[model samples]
Target: MIFLNVALKNIYMFQDAKLDLSYPRKLPSSTVENEWLEDFPKINFKRVLILSGANASGKTVFGKVLCIINNYIAGSSINQSTSWLDIKKVMFDKKKPTSFKVEFLTPKTAQAHKLAVIFDQDGLIEESYTCIDLQRNEPQSAMYKRLREFEPTSYYHKTKNNHDITNAGFTSVAVSQGKMKVPSMWNYRLCEVDNTSGSQGRITAHDTNIIKTFLSAFDSSITKVKSIAAESYKIEFSNGEHVLIDKGKLLDPDRLSRGTHEAIDIAMFYEAMKNESFGESATFYLDEMLAYSHTEAEQSILNLLIDTLPRHSQLFYSTHNYDILDMNLPVHSHVFLKKDKYSEFIQPEKMGYNQNDRSLLGYVKNDVFGTLPSMDAINNL
Candidate 1:
């Protein structure tokens, strides 16, 4: 399933925060629709999302919340797991039920669904699911209009307890067997500061090559990456510097730079995509993992990912790299997060910056979008 829109409510510090993946209609779409699914020819929803924001603007929080919601949709976890308590003392402090509205597409089923969920500390209290009768070659706007016109009786309200409301998504053999929601192919990776690089998942010859090329771009001192074992890796530096991973744990981690470490984590994500290369649909989110890499290398990686991903997939990338704005990409691909009372996803194209002639980087640098970091504290210090 592909996420089109999502909203969070009643969660502490995250009330009514909406994330939209829809491409702005007013902007001229790419002649080559790499970011759209062929199943919905008239509806060109975004397939690549470049998320940028100031520090403390909730980039990691966005990925974390989406991960939980993905789990909720897949029936892997529900009822707002206690694990969220560690996020913040303020989280879940309110008496109100944590609620969400999710709009997604299950293209294999040839239908789109809108989900409404309300859950308390215990379990799910109320939830509703509505599906649009997808017509062949119908545009998203038209389909939504038809959904609105459809009778209310078609809506599928959850009948059971929260945990059991698992049967909420596409009803397939997987759902019948109590495995998971159908088409559950998604990945979420946190940055090095927020998550440990666990054994750099699914190492392979492909990942090793990609890792070597990527690491070399950032640090030319790195010469080679070779597999030492099923999970171990040997990194050889030209200056005779070496780093070893024995069964996925870095030995003498200080010998490894933060940039190289995150590259390994990113290679893991690549490994994931490689495994799913043949799959129909997938979703991947990487949060600020490219912090140490140069914008040039980021552009290369972004291009490679765009080429590598399946046609029916979307990748959400979060970073503070403004250099990316200089690249010739659609303004709709970007969502800038700024926080006051809560976070807001600002779409430049949606905000009337339609033409590609203007300088996105300049606008951002000049604080036109108001996403530039405030230097007040550091200046005062």
Candidate 2:
């Protein structure tokens, strides 16, 4: 599934915001070649998006929003009383209901699906899902809508299947009749590594190659990686040194640096994707992906993400690293989040800058995107 856009209201720092993943009508000349994935020969969509902002500017909150939406759509149970939290007393009203709307497309039919929900501290208030035929510019015959009124707690549902649903769970109704296919989605936060155990046996050449490719990108000294035990692995370096990872713990005379750990974690994830452990069409949220890496290593990992990621998947990563701003990514792929304000997409031409300039440092310094924080108060302190 490819996400087209998301709209949220009364969710944490977001009062009302929309994130659009679809490509804009105009193209930036300096955009990276083959930066977009083509759904059809004539229709293309962006696969990589970067979120940037100062500390506490809602970048991570935005990532969490995606996670919430993913969990809800995947039919994961949630606590209604505590799940819906208002921004604050000043910005929130007891009478207001939080809402979210998500728009996406399925690979099989290319139908545009819009799923929306309204809820409050008590429980779900209303929900609806509509599928639109993009080719014909009309909505499909199958649609699902639910409203809560007479019974305050129960919901009245209407669908093409004509099933009578009262007080039914939103996810249950949505997943019924095989109407919605839940996509594989994962959120990778800083330093969080998958610790699933690998059996102790002869490591296949394919596994060896995958490990080497990952380590070589950060440190060329690494020669081989083998599963030493369950949830553990041994790393062999060309310099006759060894390092052991036991259950995500690094055991070496000189402990592996955070950067190394980050690389290993990402490499293992990529290897899993290569092995088809993660099904096709997954969406990955990499929060502060470059937190532990230096400039050079960060660039290397970015290159790996661009080159090795499955063509059918999409990646949304947040970063404070300015070097990323210098990359040849398209202008539409950059999202700038502001504190207590609306997030927006950056258009280079609109800001009187050429796309090929590669002078993002200057842009931020001049407040072209308004994500940079004002340090004047710090000096006063």
Candidate 3:
């Protein structure tokens, strides 16, 4: 999705804005709420934020929350809808209905608030959120329209009074599924772009740029040059190897056996981030960013992202891989996640550890984040 469609003003619109697979140069010492200030580090970034957590540690939930906030700020009515009234029941709906709320930021126009889509476990959503001014607790219309513009039309088209897709406020914002969320055409589009240079109607031009830019960062041993004809994609290799995969094969771009191809894709993503012009104060998040690379290659990509990208873009990521951790990137960048018996996920900072400590992962493995059984219980036998 494009935000405030001001032509590259929002970095979150780019796929490369996914995640920065590096260590944090700095961490937020604390977070403040309701006149109480905690020692949370104030996180600042010229690049994207990276997040780490184990399965069900709530990392993805956190990302969705941020996107929801972004949408609320952009303006989409997601809170006033009736779908959230019976949250637990609807969330567990075997054939549940998705719940969404859209609130106009201002009563006079559609630009003051944002939209929220909450997914309930069994089926659709159970709760929705719309911006309630932090201070006034009221909605704004103009803001809602601004944020609405970034969401996919399919999401809002089902709602009443939201058919307008050309409003300037609606056109400026953009949002997409996080790295884990896949679109059907994702793979085909990658193969097509791998064979072609420009996006030119095949897909979003910026997305196409991101693909080419990411691929060029790999070692020359891997070649991504391709030719497109008859609505098909052809990927060529420098070693005289050729494989024609389906368009949808794009879902797992890094699943290929060759490290070079995986490296090339990761590099391309990094290059896109490095070369991005996403002005100041934009945010991006990618989930499980290290799936495709060797530790060394992941490290190379991280270095470029941290050192090379413009300081305007902020990034975040979620991953369970420790290869990224052992890379000696930085301590503050690492956020550990673990789950409790209650099925609740916790972060290192939440469990009373100095988030800035390099030993964070060590503690996580030892059940510091609640992943380990009690020592007494284990030794009882």
Candidate 4:
């Protein structure tokens, strides 16, 4: 099954995983509702913010909060879709009514909007609820019912579920259908280059062009993979042609490493984001942004996304690999999560750092953040 615009958009390697039962699922929905927002972190987010924390820290939880809020405002939701089953793996569940409240300022929407969602043991007890913190406004009210119904095809409203979006804004919500539909242009384009005899001539002329475009987003030269279908995927350039190796034979993608499977998947996902127009306002929350890349290629994948994705879109992703934090990224880009003595997932900000001195990587290295264990600790254990 395909999932559209539900999690992350554009980048393929960083897409969220579809739950297949083998993955450890979280508590039942009823237990999710008892938790409440103790407080909101006071931080000015960038066009892109990375919520980095320990294993159980609220990084994924914050991402869910944003997702629920966005889907509510855009009239596009994934509540009815099983594609979000992976979200259970990402979010923190206390087996109680859990509430999330966030005050955010979108680039277009200037008003301070308060959005909240409460998930209890009874199954999504509260969907995202929005509120406008206007001085003249009275008590909280439902915003979804008052929205302009911008996307009639959106499945969010089709479901009989009720979400609270009293203070939610326009750019805050979007919908995610279970399956994805690739645009005809991309399909035709890929097919055109499907079968040619030469290294470059075998596929459609656009084949190399597509690969070039895909690689241009990164800071490094194109990654050299022997075959898109193999474990040691390498690239060999000769006579103005790229050859993928399979069983020691110099051939095109039809014969290569298993990485080819990943390549095709990436190509399809990229087409979805490039062809779709969600206007300029969109935010994607991917549970794991590096699902297909090799350990060394993960950073390159992220760099490509950071380069190709338009500034209008915001992304939030989670990963167990400390390699993602290898570089000295900005402090604000991360939100360190750790379980406090109370066994609740809490952000480093809530734990009483100066905020200015709070470093997610540092907290993680020192083991002061999030409920989950650290990579070093995990490895050493």
Per-residue lDDT tens digits for candidate 3, residues 158-248, read: 2343335422122112232121111111011021122211121132222333444444444443365453533233455577765543442
Better of 1 and 4 by lDDT: 1
Instruction: State the lDDT of candidate 4 residue by residue for 1-381, as single tens digits.
Output: 001112221111212221110001112331112111112122123333344545444444445444443444444332434533122233334353444433333333322333334443333443342323222222112222222222222222213543443322222222223121211110111111121111111121123344434443321334443335532234533333455434323346543344443444344334333433433334444444444456566566555545544434444555566666554443334443443432232334334542443335565666655344546765888
Q: What is the lDDT of residue 171 in candidate 2?
A: 45
Q: How would you order the candidates by TM-score, starting with the best?
A: 1, 2, 3, 4
TM-score of each: 0.84, 0.76, 0.47, 0.46
As for candidate 2, its clashing pairs are none
Alpha-carbon lDDT of model 3: 0.37
For model 4 the local lDDT of residue 158 reads 16
Superposed by TM-score, candidate 3 places the C-alpha of residue 222 at a distance from the truth, in angstroms, of 2.9
lDDT of 2 by residue, 141-184 (tens): 22112111121221224333325553444343565545555563
Error of 2 at 104 (Å): 0.5
TM-score of 1: 0.84
The list of candidate 2 runs beyond 4 A from truth reads 26-44, 80-95, 136-172, 176-178, 190-208, 216-223, 237-241, 248-254, 273-277, 341-359
Q: Where does candidate 3 stray beyond 4 Å?
A: 1-49, 76-221, 227-234, 244-255, 258-268, 271-277, 327-330, 341-352, 355-357, 372-381
List the candidates ranked by lDDT, beginning with the highest: 1, 2, 3, 4
